[model samples]
Target: MNIIGGPAQDGEWPWQIALMWNNIYVCSAALLTPDWAVTTAQCVNQEASGYSILIGTNNLAEWSPNYQRQPVASVYKHPEYNTRIHDFDVALLRLTDPVEITDYSRTICIPTTDMSFEVGTTCYASGWGSSDGINEFLQEAQFSITSSNNCEGVTSNMLCADGIESSGACAGDEGGPLVSLVDTRWYLVGLTSKTTCGSGADVFTRMTAMYEWIAPILDGETPLSK
Candidate 1:
């Protein structure tokens, strides 16, 4: 958690990944497939450099059997991403190779249809961001999807959530997931895009809106021959 929150329990968010640049945590990302992940463009618009992903671990300070770090092979940012306003803030990272899927590492299920979560829908936000730069454990919080009409700076394509003052994603939490539990399964609906910590509601890029650009790439990849 950033401004306010607690650490997530191990195995709580198996789909979570840490995106790092030159070994420093930059933002959080969601594993969509063994070889592909999604994050915010703001985290990757900079000049290409050494980028890697940490998977299958909740604790970042120490290593475990579940921990696996893989280098990024390529970056694909949404073409319409408006860097000025952080609109359409989404990006995809291709891994050098597919990661091993285990009990502690898994892919998140994304919505297939153009579904909209109504206001007050409960969703979970998870990341590893902190202001003091001391938090090493993954953090998460429960937030309800709200209307962006009153949230200043929020756009139509972004999903807004309330209670960010008391609980929500923090710095370094950028590009992490805002997921909704549907039918006993978690569905990624948004990405932590922008926020003011305790001052205002947090905003996340609606994942469904990016489906058109993401689906094609995901569909083209076949599972590695085991």
Candidate 2:
């Protein structure tokens, strides 16, 4: 069994969102705007038509039972996203209606053009990924620091993060948030794109490289993040 960190404690950035489909649930997503969410393109790639965005809840158990279920109005996959190379695997989803950001549903701060994370620098990742190597249908959030490098042999856009011990994202944790604390505020540096499906380094799509593409969408100036 894969042993990992404990679930997210109360009141630590409660703006996370849970993406649900059928019996498969992925703790992958972060609220980017009142009407938009930042996650992995692959999360919506196969079944874009059937996914629902559950917002306004830190507690996954209460998500479906208590929170509002918003239909995905549109999905914007990066034009260059290639599953083969895993390049540009980032995507944004526009909700049919704007979700009111409460204490439990706030928009995450995106990094400014000047901010950049380096290798060996510590960052935090949270999601309803697996715990104890057991895959549950429910979602649970855990934390992990950034890895040493952003996939050294792989492409530059891929960011890496290792668990402090046996803690990290797993198979069902894709399309979540890989955040970095800069100047006391947490910036959405990466989107949890993929991992090895067990206790291993989790990969994310670097937000820095995709700023230009994502900016217009967040600002409502463009219909897509491409």
Candidate 3:
């Protein structure tokens, strides 16, 4: 996650999640529902016995009263996810316990409608990773939707964004959320799939393109899931 930006305040991005592997912060995630979180399949594939989720706090160095750490009950990587190219890069995480709703912990809306996050729409990408070193607190940067054509390897299932000049940072932003505000509510429009960190050409798994694969998983428990 390339988080070359300012530290985020508590509750600024409540849906944000800190993905843990062996108790160490690895990548970021988004709370999809009280019981479910969303991240990249790449992140899931790196899982080990210590997999867990850290919610309700912006800082990872300290465990506060609002902090809640839950073990991951299960992981569901998309069936069509491609490790070679990272296509269909999302994965759903089932938490052992539902995260209690609070100002510091909540879920964000995912794109599931016949809509497009048109070019030029402003969006924000947040994470706790560093471009140079690990950050103790969450950080964020703003980006503007750019034509996918600007970046090579852009695919039909991806959307591209260019970081604003004065901002943008990255250390290990894998599986972070790229969200946009629409009519007062923030929607998760993309997942950090790929990036050329320094120049800010981010390639994200466009959530809209995965509605078919995601809608079903979100509606009811699938009979068979990874």
Q: Largest lDDT belongs to which candidate?
A: 3
Model 3 agreement with the true structure over 97-195: per-residue lDDT tens digits: 899999889899988758779999999998876667667888888988899887678888888888887455365788899999999889999998886
lDDT of 2 by residue, 122-218 (tens): 6666666654433433333344445545343346677777656556666656787777777777788787766654456767788888787888976
Clashing pairs in 2: 29-176, 128-140, 147-161
RMSDs, each prediction?
3.9, 3.3, 1.9
User: Candidates' lDDT values, in order?
Assistant: 0.81, 0.67, 0.82
For model 1, state the Cα shift of residue 88 in Å.
0.7
Per-residue error at 174 for model 2, in Å? 0.5
Q: Write candidate 1's Cα lDDT for 27-68 as tens digits.
A: 899999998988999989544469999988887788557888
For candidate 2, what is the lDDT?
0.67
The best candidate by TM-score is 3
TM-score for each predicted model, relative to the true structure: 0.92, 0.82, 0.93
Preferred candidate (TM-score higher): 1 or 2: 1
Candidate 3 contains a number of clashing pairs equal to 12
